[model samples]
Target: MTIAVVWLEDDGLWCVSDTRISRRGQGGGVQIVTDAGAKIYPLNVECRLLTVERELYYGRRYGMVFAGMTAVATQTFATLSGMCQALQGASRQDIPSLRDVATLLSKLVELYVRDFRASTTLADPGVIEILLFGMCPVSRSYEIWRVSDQIVEGSLHVAIDQQPARTGDVVAIGSQVSRFQEILAELKQKTENTFRLPKIAVGQMADASRGDVGGAVSIGICNQFGFQTYWSLGLTPHGQGARLMFGVDLDDIGWVGPVVISGGGMA
Candidate 1:
C-alpha cells in the first residue's frame, strides 16, 4: 500500500503519492518490488486535426493520483489515456471535463473487475482509488473528485474507505494510515497546521510506511494548464562515470546536483 494525500489551499489543488509497489515475499512478508513506478500521472492532451491546407490544435489536461493495487490502477488508466486521443477533431462538448471523470471511472472499474474475475482465481484486489484534480470547465474553478472501486464476494474485502474531501479540506488514503498516526502526531507537535504544510505531512507519512511505501514522492498541483507534477530531475553514475537521468517528483523545493555534458550521453 502507498499513501496519496490531497488538499486544497487557496485556489490550488495539491496532491502527493509515493511510488512504491510491494508484494508478498517468499517468506510471506511484504517485499518491495519496485520503487520507481509512478502513481501520479500528469496527463496533457493536445489534439490536432489536419484540414484543407491548415492544422488546428486543442489542448487540455487532467492530473490524477492513485492508491492501492498497482495492477488495478494500471488497467484503469490505460483506458483513460485512450480517451485523451479521441479528443481530436471533436467539439468542446465531447471533451470530458472534471465532472465526467467519476462516471468514466465507474465504467472502467466495473469492466476491469468483471473481466479480471472471469480470467483468474486470484484473490480480489482491494479498492483502487483515485483523486482526479483539475479545473472545472464550467465553473472555472479548481476541483478534486474522489472515485473508488472494491470487489466483495461472500467473505473477503480489503481497502481504504476514504471520505470525499471537500474544498479547503485534506484527506490521506492508504493501508498504512493508522500506522502513520503516531509519527504524524509527533510531527504535528512540532509543526503548526500540518495540513497547510503538505511537504512535511506528506514526507512524514511516506517515511512512516517503512518498507511498504518508499519512493520518490510524486506531488502535483492544479493550474490553468491542468494538473502538472512538481517535478525535478535526478542523475547518478551508472557502472562507470556516465550518469542516467530520472524524473523525480518533488515533495519540497528541489535541489540540483552536479551537471556534466558528455558527447555520448548525459553525465
Candidate 2:
C-alpha cells in the first residue's frame, strides 16, 4: 500500500507520495519493502520510456499521482504513455483537452478490468485510485480529477470525478488517507504549525503498521509554467541540499511566482 497527497494552494498544485511496496509472504504475513518504488507519473511528456524519477516531471504540464495495486498502476502508466505518443503524432490543434484525457483514462481502466476478469478468477484486481491534476489550457485554471476503479459483482467499475480547485483545497488517497485527514485537521486547529504540510503527511504514513508506507517522499508541482519536481528521493545529495537551502531552482524549472489565471497560453 501507498499514500499520496495532493493540495491546491495559491501558488499551484502540490503532490506528494511515499515509496513503499508490500506483498503477502508465505506465512500469510505482509512483507514490506521500501526505497525502490514510486507512485507519481507525469503525463504529456516527450520520452520513449518513462523513468519514474527523472522523467516524471520532465517536459510535463500535466501529471497523475497514483496509489494502490502496483500492477494496475503500471498498466495505467502504459495507457497514458500510449495516449501521449498518439497526441504527439497529431497536429498541435488536435491535442486532447484535459477533460478528454480524463475520459480516456477512465476507459483504459475499464478495459484493464475487463481483461483482468477474463484471465483470472479474482473478484477484484485490488483498489486503484488516480488523481489527475494539471492546468487546463482552455479554461486557464488548475483542475483535479479523481479516477478510481473497483470490483463490483466480479466486474470492474470505473468512475471519473472532476473539480476545479480553489485555493487551500487538499486531497489524499491510499491506505493511510484517514490518518492524513486527521493530521490536516489537527494542523488547521493549531495556530503555529511548525511542520511542512507534505512532510507531515509523509511522516504519518511512514509510522503506519510495519511501515508499509514508509520511505522517501517525492513531490512535484504543476501550474501555468509547467510541471517540475519540488522534491524527490532520487535527487543527488547535492541537489537535495541545494533545494533545502534555496527553495526551488526557479532558473532551471521556470518560476510561476504569483500567477493570475487568465484565458491565454502558458506563461
Candidate 3:
C-alpha cells in the first residue's frame, strides 16, 4: 500500500509518498518487501520530449508519482524518464505541453495494460494511479493531472483527468482514503494556504500507519524551474553514482530512496 499526496500550491506543487512496497496475504494481511523504493521523480532540462506541438507551446514542468502495480508504473515511468533525459539537451521552445505529455502517457498505459492482459493469465494489470503536478507554460498556471488504469467488468478502464487545485484543497489517494478526511479538515481550519500542515500531517500518519503504509517519505516540487525530487522531507542526497529510478538514471542526479509531501493551496 502507498500513501501519496499532491498539494498544489499557488507558486508550485508540493508532493509526498511513502516508499514501502508490500504484498498481501490471502488472510488479509500485508507484508513489507522493501522500504527504499523510489516514488516521486523530479524531471528537468536533462530530458526534452519532442512533439509536433513543440513549436506551438512549451509543455508543463511537472513532477510525477504513482501507486499500484510497481512493474507497470515503473516500466512506464522508466520510458518517460528516458524521454526526459534524451530531450534534456533539446531546445525548450520545442518541448510538448501538459496536454500532449498527458496524452502520450495515457496511450502508453493503455498499451501496456492490453499487452499484459493478453500475455498473462492475470485478469488485468491491476490498479494504477499516477499523479502529475506542475505549471503549464501556456496558461502560466499550476495544474494537477491524474492518469489511471484498471480492469473493470472484464474490460480495461483508462482515465486522464485534469485537477488543478486552489487554496484549501488537499488531494490524497492510496491505501488510506477515509482516514485522511479529518486530518485534512483540521489542517484546513488551521491554515487556509500553507504546505507545512500537509507535510506534518502526512509524517504523523505514516509514523502511525498500519502495515498498509510504511517507510520514510519522498518529496518534491514542480514549478517554473521544473521538477525537484528529494529522498526525504526537504533532504536531497548528492554524489550517489548513477542512481536509478524505475530502471533509468536521471542524468546522474543524486537520488535514492523515497519522497516527501508538503501539500497546501494558495490563491
Local distance difference test, each candidate: 0.61, 0.65, 0.65
lDDT of 3 by residue, 1-267 (tens): 577888866476788777678877768698777756777776442334355544322323478888776777887787876665455324655555666677777877887767766776765346678887777666667778889887778789888998756766767777775665667667778876755566666666665647867655666767677877653432124534333332233444443456423233211
- Go through the candidates in order and give the clash count of each: 0, 0, 15
Model 2: per-residue Cα lDDT over 100-188, one tens digit each: 77888888877776676677655544567888888876567788888888766765679899854766667788877787788777766
Residue 142 lDDT, candidate 3, scale 0-100? 75
TM-score of each: 0.72, 0.73, 0.73
- Per-residue CA lDDT of model 1 for 28-141, tens digit only, reads 778987766688886555555544523436567777778776787888888877866555554434445556655666577667755665676756455567777777676677
Q: On a 0 to 100 scale, what is the lDDT of residue 29 in model 1?
A: 70
Put the candidates in lDDT order, highest first: 3, 2, 1
TM-score of candidate 3 relative to the true fold: 0.73
* Model 2: lDDT of residue 228: 62
Which whole-number lDDT from 0 to 100 does residue 34 have in model 1?
72
Please give the range of 10 consecutive residues that has the lowest summed lDDT in model 3. Answer: 258-267
